[model samples]
Target: MRRFVIGDIHGGLKGLQQVLNRCNLKEEDKVIFLGDYVDGWSESEKVIDYLITLNGNQNCVFLRGNHDDLLLNYLKTNQFNKEWFQHGGESTIEAYQKVDSKTIQNHIEFLESLQDYYIDEANRLFIHAGFTNLKGVEFEYFKPLFYWDRTLWECALALNLNLNRDSVYYPNRLKLYQEIYIGHTPVTRIGITIPHNIANVWNLDTGAAFKGPLTILDIDSKEFWQSDPLHTLYPNERGRN
Candidate 1:
């Protein structure tokens, strides 16, 4: 069975659909989604609904992202976070306005069931963002760091390519897993619109929340597929720009 890891969707349901189709998914294959499934375009509620259905038919792992946590909080408390609103939450709020209470409650339960991270049998760590503990995820003191941290990616990027994993100067965090897969920090910031790798960390977030396409990478073969740029798919909307 092939194992694929997908980047952030950010309510770009069309892009999500396109990539999934292009990937030629099979029932036996496993798909791990690195969150931020909502809050950017107009279909946040639909995206969640679609994911709930997808999970039932396939082997899927969903990791929690910061934006998802924000939406969950608002759904449960009815208190909007100003920061979340500015960063694509307005679209989510509007999307849910016409939905019935039962559906909203189901969505909330799905959000609450999301995992902070997942470690496969191959020892690869899959997380929505980064973890900070030197002792690794099991020892992480701050739970939010699993979905909010950027330092892990930054550390991977800042490392000298020549540094061997066996070298004393290599980061212990990097040594903790066979590989690490993450989203949250878009690789588009560095001007690349594809899955990027640094040290052993593979960042799959190709900025689908903004202008780039949604991406899915085959964890074993390193092959990948992407949808058209989100801007092209949602021409009428500005996404998170």
Candidate 2:
């Protein structure tokens, strides 16, 4: 069975469907989502619905992103979080509003069930953002760094390829895993429009939160599949501007 890891979706239902169709996932194949499933676009509820359906038919691992945490917090408190709204969550708010109370509760439960990170036997670590200060698989501290850190990627990107492996600082940074896959800070921030791999860390977030396409990377092969650019999929809409 093949393993596929998808990057941040940001409410691109069409893009999500396209990637899944392209993968043609079999029952034994596993799909890991790096999160940010909602917000940015107008079909947040639809995206949740589709994921819920997919869970019934496939082995899926869903990680919680910062945006998802905001939505869950709002659900528990029933208070309109301005920050959530500020981050293109207005569309998500509107989407949730259209659904019935029961459906909304179900969606909230699903979000709560999402994990902060995933580790496979192959030593690949999958997280929504990055990991910091985690001594081992069981980190005594639980923080949003799992879905918000960026310095890890920055460090990985800045490393000199010719530098001696023994001379590396913080070499044990993510010692628990042989490789890492993350989505949160889009690779576009570094002036690239596709997934970037550095020091075995793969940044699969191809900026679909704005202009790039949705990316899905094969865990073993490092091959990928992507949806159309977000703009082309939803013209006249600038998601999370």
Candidate 3:
């Protein structure tokens, strides 16, 4: 089975489907999403719905991003907060309002159940952002650890030029997993760098939500596919806001 890791989707269902179609995703293939499944686009709810369906029938794994974090907090309290509304959270709110309350709750639960990091059979690490401690820390324990806070990563960026090293989060000599695949900070204008490295970690945000393209990377084969949404119909004003 081919293992694939994708960058942040950011609720662009059309972009997501386009990338998947280009890849010719198969039932046996394992796919890992780098998170930020909602916000920025018009189909936040649809994206979540599609993933929920995919999770039931396929080997699809979802990682939580900062956007997903805001969504989870908003859902549990049934209230909209500043951080949620500020960062394209308003778009998600609009999408969620279209669906019934029960559906919204179910979708939120599905988001909550997602793992912060997904390690492939080869031990390639995948997270929404990047990891802090690679040895014993779970992404769920410190939710923000999955996406933000790059103090240690910045240090690693200065030290590792060939992209080989231990966990930068801690001071121990613990060896980290193979390679880390992450989204959140973009590279490609539409789909920035396929393997953009900042702190010995690869970032694949690709900016699909903005002027960039959606990206899909075949982990085992190192092949890549990208699709641009700007070529299609212009997004609505909501997508811009």
Task: Note the Cα lDDT for every prediction shown.
Answer: 0.95, 0.85, 0.72
Candidate numbers sorted by TM-score from highest down: 1, 2, 3
Worst 10 residues of 3 by lDDT: 166-175
Q: How big is the positional error of residue 186 in model 3, measured in Å on the Cα after superposition?
A: 1.1
Candidate 1: stretches off by over 4 Å: none
Q: How accurate is candidate 1 locally (lDDT)?
A: 0.95
Off by over 4 Å in 3: 134-141, 151-175, 188-193, 197-200, 230-234, 238-241
TM-scores for candidates 1 onward, in order: 0.99, 0.94, 0.84
Candidate 3, backbone clash total: 10
List the pairs of residues colliding in candidate 3.
Answer: 187-192, 188-191, 188-192, 188-193, 189-212, 190-212, 190-213, 191-206, 191-213, 192-206
Model 1 agreement with the true structure over 137-235: per-residue lDDT tens digits: 999999999999999999999999998888999999999999999999999999999999998999999999999999999999999999999989999
Global Cα lDDT for candidate 3? 0.72
Error of 2 at 155 (Å): 1.7
How many pairs of residues collide in each model? 0, 0, 10
Candidate 2 has an lDDT of 0.85
Ranking by lDDT: 1, 2, 3
Residues 1-241, candidate 3, lDDT per residue (tens digit)? 8888888777788888888899999999989888888888778889888999888888988888888888888877878778668778888887776798899789878877878777766667787765555353453456677777453344444554554454454333124556667787666533444556554366677777666777888887768887775225235444533
